[model samples]
Target chain A: MTIQPAFQCERLCIDLPGAPGVRRIIEDLDLEVGRGQFVSILGGSGTGKTTLLRALAGLTSHSSGRAVYEGREVRSPVPGMAMVFQDYAHALLMWRTVRRNVALGVEGRLRNGELDQKVQNAIRMVGLERFRDEYPWRLSGGMQQRVQIARALAMEPSALLMDEPFGALDAMTKASLQDQLLAVQAETGATVLFVTHDIEEAIYLSNTIILLKGSPAHIARRITVDLPRPRDQIVTKELPEYLRLRHQLFEAFRHEIHA
Target chain B: MMTAVNAPAPAVAGGKERPWIFHAADNVWSALQGLLPLIALLLLWQMLGDSRSPYFPPPSTWAAALIDRTNSGDLIPAVLVTLQSVAAALILATSLGVGIGGLIGASPALARCLGPTLEFLRTLPPPTIVPVAALIIGVNETMKLFVIVFAALWPVLLNTTLGVRSLHPTLLEAARSLQLGVVARMTKIFLPALLPSILTGVRVAAPLAIIVSLLAEMLTLMPGLGALLLMAQRNFNAAEVFGLLTVVGSFGFILNAALAAFESWALMPQGRT
Candidate 1:
């Protein structure tokens, strides 16, 4: 017997309402994400990578075709699934302190002091223990984003959907958050569906990278990262194999830019 | 990356570093700007006017009569009655407005159904309906409350609806994705998003509530500051009348001070902008 994948999309088509009329974003897209896999969807500007992630999370409806989470059809946001929105400031409840914001997903659901325990653990995971009592608005942008991530983690989600989670950060913050994300992923082993336009980020984080291109976006390229686990920012990125992949992907990106 | 070491230790208890007394003082200064003309006029009246004048008694006589009223004990109770009614009406109006406005704002169908009726009623002055209220609810405190609440409800309701309409789409999406139920969504997501506008509405409605409370008391001859003023007027006690006006003005000042503190506390939890 075969293990069921975490997410499966068969001919998934998405049409978003544009100014002129209904515009197709993604059409006839097929994907199979195995359990605990880190799949990053990469695309240029205006590509439907984020839209695809939203569709998979059942945030936005697909025009046609089937998108499934685990064994169930994706109609609404599923249980055991959490999303970290790109705009952390807007996504987070500004009025809530760090602890309360992190506890949002599991606030009333957990019992017997489990809720507090989960909130504390998630805050600790994101290294925001010192700022737990402070409002998200008081924190720096990167810290605010960490609160968003902690909020998702508190859910103890089986599958996590992230849309350019570190896109807005400075280089140092981005690098640190990337490693922290990897550490959390190693510990939790949650299936991650990440969306980004950064080639290096996609290469570093994902087990599989799905490059989306064109207006009615389709899977233009699918690249698999066979790099060893415990990937490092300094060491893994400097490896000969990693360098080779980087050179090839950049060339593909250059061709993409002109085409 | 431990960047929080220099993260500017934000004052946790108070949103601002300034003392609350000073904060209230600052707000009082701005509020007093509009009343400067009245204050100047009163100072002039005190400097030139005689104490025996029936129409333009000196400020000193106003104070004397107020002290007399205080000694007789009618002043404190009347003030308390007026204050209580204003507080109660405000709470009721805010509750009704936020609840109903949130519902209407959340649903286009409901907003459409009620929009026309609300427009018609909100514009028709609450005082004009005083006779209708008296005929139906009778000349009681309930009728007074109903009229005040009706007057004050509009600002909060309309502001809330606008707030909900302009609410960040991403925030709604986030709430939906989190699977928050209707009640939770309102209290946590909707309330905070609409808070600034809600506060704006309440600020506009507060004075209106106070004035309407006074109006109802005067019109119905109920036991409040308004009725006290009416009695003094009928009895031809010009000193008491001027004194009561001064007392009302002082009470308004105190309430404004209280409002400053309340606004600071309520809005301090977090700020969107």
Candidate 2:
């Protein structure tokens, strides 16, 4: 028997309310994400990448077509699926402590000791154990993003949807967080659909990259990275294959821009 | 990263641990500092006023009149009646305001529909309602309560509506994504988020409630401090009039302080540091 895909979208389209009537932000698009696979949706600023991610998470309603998760129609947010937003500061509950924020997804479902254990485990996974008692506002931007990730992790979702999770972070912080995210994905073995505008980030993190282009965007290209497991930042970037993939992604983006 | 290290510690939890007594002493010292200006003003009043004047009495004469009223057991009961009325009105107004405000705020259509009506009602002087209430309900506790509620309900309702309307959309999304039920959404998310604004409305309303209650009492010749003040004024008992006014001022000050303390205690958990 064959295993089903984690998420499948068929001709998904999104029309957001605009001043002049409904505006199409996402055109008919089809994609499938396998379990335990790390896929990055790369696009320019207005290419509807985030909209696609949101639609997959069931946070956005598709104007046409369907988004199916594990054979279930995703009309609304489903259980066992978590999302990490880009604006971590607003995404996190500043009133809550780090542990409380992490526990937000699971507190209502889990019991006392089990809840604490899960919260601690998630925080530990994100290397934020020491800051558990601190408030989100007290933490750094990168730390705040980590707390958000920890919150998503505590849900123990089958699939994690992230929309440019490290887009707002400093370059150094962004690099470190990218590696941390890789470690997390490897440990949990959960399917990840990461949305980012950065070509290099998409190349570095994704096993499969879906490039979105055009007005009311649709998938323009799909490339698979066959790089070795446990990828290193410094070492992998120096490799010939990694460099070639990066160049190809750059060319794809440039072509999209020019076209 | 560098900003995080140099950021000031959270005011709620940071700093060296101090004994309970030290904190209490700090509160007491601050309270004394607040009272300093009042004390100075009273001293100036005593130095300037003539004891024998019918229009203006000295501090000693006012003190004597207060003692006389207290000895007769009239002052305490009057103060109690006024306080009870204000307290009852405030409780009723708060519940109604929050409930109505939440409903109106949650629906933009309802808010827009009722906006003009609410604004018109709010603009009508609260004291104007006192006589109307007295005429309709008769001179009684009900009349005072009606006046107070009519007068004070607007601020709390308006503030709560504004707060609810301004709630972060992302927070609502977060709540929905977590699959929070309606009850949990209201109690855990909506209520706490709307609390600061609710308290602000209550603060404004509390003083208004007291003022309206006093106004109702004076206008209708009801039993309260307001009635006593009006009676003293009629009798030309300057000392007694001044003494009652001073008591009313103190009540206002105490109410304000108590509400402020409650606001801090309730909001501290939300990390306003």
Candidate that scores best on lDDT: 1
Report, to 2 decimal places, the DockQ of model 2: 0.55
Interface RMSDs of the predictions, in order, are: 0.9, 1.6
State the lDDT of candidate 2 residue by residue for A206-244, as single tens digits. 999999988888888999998887988898888898999
lDDT (Cα, tens digit) per residue for candidate 2, span B21-112: 33344454687799999889889989997778988887789989999999999999999999999999999999989999899999999988
**Which lDDT tens digits does candidate 1 get at residues A156-212?**
999999999999999999999999999999999999999998989888998998989
DockQ of each: 0.70, 0.55
Note the residue pairs that clash in candidate 1.
none
Candidate 2, lDDT over the whole model: 0.86
Q: Candidate 2 chain A: worst 10 consecutive residues by lDDT?
A: A250-259
Docking class of 2: medium
For all candidates, what are the clash counts?
A: 0, 0
Give the DockQ (C-alpha) for candidate 1.
0.70
